[model samples]
Target: MGEYKPPFTITNKILSYISSISEKIGRITAISNLETKPHLRRNNRIKSIHSSLKIEANSLTLGQVRDVINGKSVLGEQKEIQEVKNAYIAYEHLEEIDPYNIQHLKQFHGIMTRYLVEESGEFRSGEEGVFNGSQCIFMAPPARFVPQLMDELFSWMKESKDDVHPLILSSVFHYEFVFIHPFSDGNGRMARLWHTAILSKWKPIFEYIPIESQIEKFQDEYYRSISECHIAGESTIFIEFMLSQIDKILDDISVQINEKNEYLPEAVQKLLEVMEYDIPYTSNELMERLGLKAKEGFRRNYLHPAMEMKLIQMTIPDKPNSRNQRYLRC
Candidate 1:
């Protein structure tokens, strides 16, 4: 086996960036401990953003990523878009059941590429190219490397004793795994998913960080950083780039948390918590649960306020007379 050595100059810069971001992430972690519905909403919003970004990055067309971020559905591409959404939903649930195992990886990849690509859940069995500019630069290791590399990665995850921060470890693992490019087609998506799994193991809050969105925001820079570090034989620059994105995303969520704390009504907030586990409620169902005498009273006093605050949304906005008209916690 070749001994791994990182580029010193880029490593130094990355370590510096990690140090700065760690302090900011610490603050976000602290605030997340407050047990409030608005805080929970903020957390869910972050998770939604993260899931959306992961789906967009993996399955959607380049233009689709922009459309999804802009709060628009890909109109003619519903099937493809739904596949991405399903992938995110799968990750959200499956990670909790088994985060690091290969089973989860296969499931994520399957959902990510269901109708979009033929090699959805399988690893690449032949040679693959890594491009730089117009040139094919690095050739991924042969098919034999896939199992060995994956085993080494999981073993390293299990046996590593150094108290290296989870964020740093996750970022490094991401870069290295993608560099290895174990899969034929979905290597990038797998790297991002595994990174989330690694971080979520450390702190559940990280599962909601939307690091991918930040990556998509600086996609060009992200690619450049990875390529530069790869060519220079250092993973540190990639680590630094990831850490900075994590910090920025955490800060963004923190602001939303604080805003929700200040403005949300207490009763409506309580309603939100109750519905977190079970959403999409009808007016009668909500009134019954809230113990209000009149359904109209509940709508005027509770639901409308929540809707106006953008905390809840009507699932059937056009069907006023429909008994099935429901409200969902957004």
Candidate 2:
């Protein structure tokens, strides 16, 4: 109400999570230029967009979102598809955002909600509610209060940049932003995007981290954390909850990196170095991407070994020579 300072305590659980996440960050850093790995970076960004939209009840699969972003025709409702396209653009332009700038948050929200909401970048002039089907769970603060509320939140964030760990600060901002319900729609998406944006500013590697995917994986728990904190009058639960999610996501990333490093065939690893994964590639397409014209030598050294190692598999495994066949990383 007055000048808002988020109330929260860093308990032992939060400290442990911070410690674990830091160690995992060191491990994840070992993959030289992992933040620059095009495939990983693109895939993570797509995953973030897809999952954040999914949490908002957008009925599009991850592949469908990826396809939409790739400029392909996706058969879905016009509004849902537009949301995906908008989110993709918003994330791709994240470099233009400033984490502690109130205007930047409004600008990003405009990008996020574009055609999906009439209010877009503007704070709602009417009351809004968080709902479960027909039932409302929480009514937002009065619309008149939004601008000043947002100003204080951003001012606190800027002033606390040195005093707060980005992890803790971002999570606190995330919870508070959701509580403020600053926009007419897309608050959840903005919260998630800004959380990653805040962390990415802290360490560029976070640009490639799919923390939203983890939130989508455990969505019920995510809502529960917010609701509990709302009742408890502090964001400590949400802070610990977020730190726990980061710990889990970083752990998963470390495992994936080590698995590929230890087991993938050298040729297949090289192939992936050039390939954008989760989509299929035909033999000719694969060869062309690698700039190899001789089919047999290319197959023996790269394709066959990759298949033998199961790093990649044929799309039509039953008929390996199917004319319509393609290959995808496993």
Model 2, position 266, has a per-residue lDDT of: 66
TM-score of 2: 0.94
Residues 1-330, candidate 2: write the lDDT tens digits.
335688899899988888888877877786556744677788888999999999899999988999999899999999999999899989998877899888888898998888778898989888887654455657889999988888888888988889898999999999999988989899999999999999989887888789999999998888888888888999999999899899999877775555455566666667776666688999999899788899998799998988887778999999998999999977
For model 2, which pairs clash? none
Please give the CA lDDT of all the candidate structures: 0.64, 0.86
lDDT of 2: 0.86
lDDT, residue 8, candidate 2: 92
Least accurate stretch of 10 residues (summed lDDT) in model 2?
255-264
Candidate 1 TM-score versus the reference: 0.66
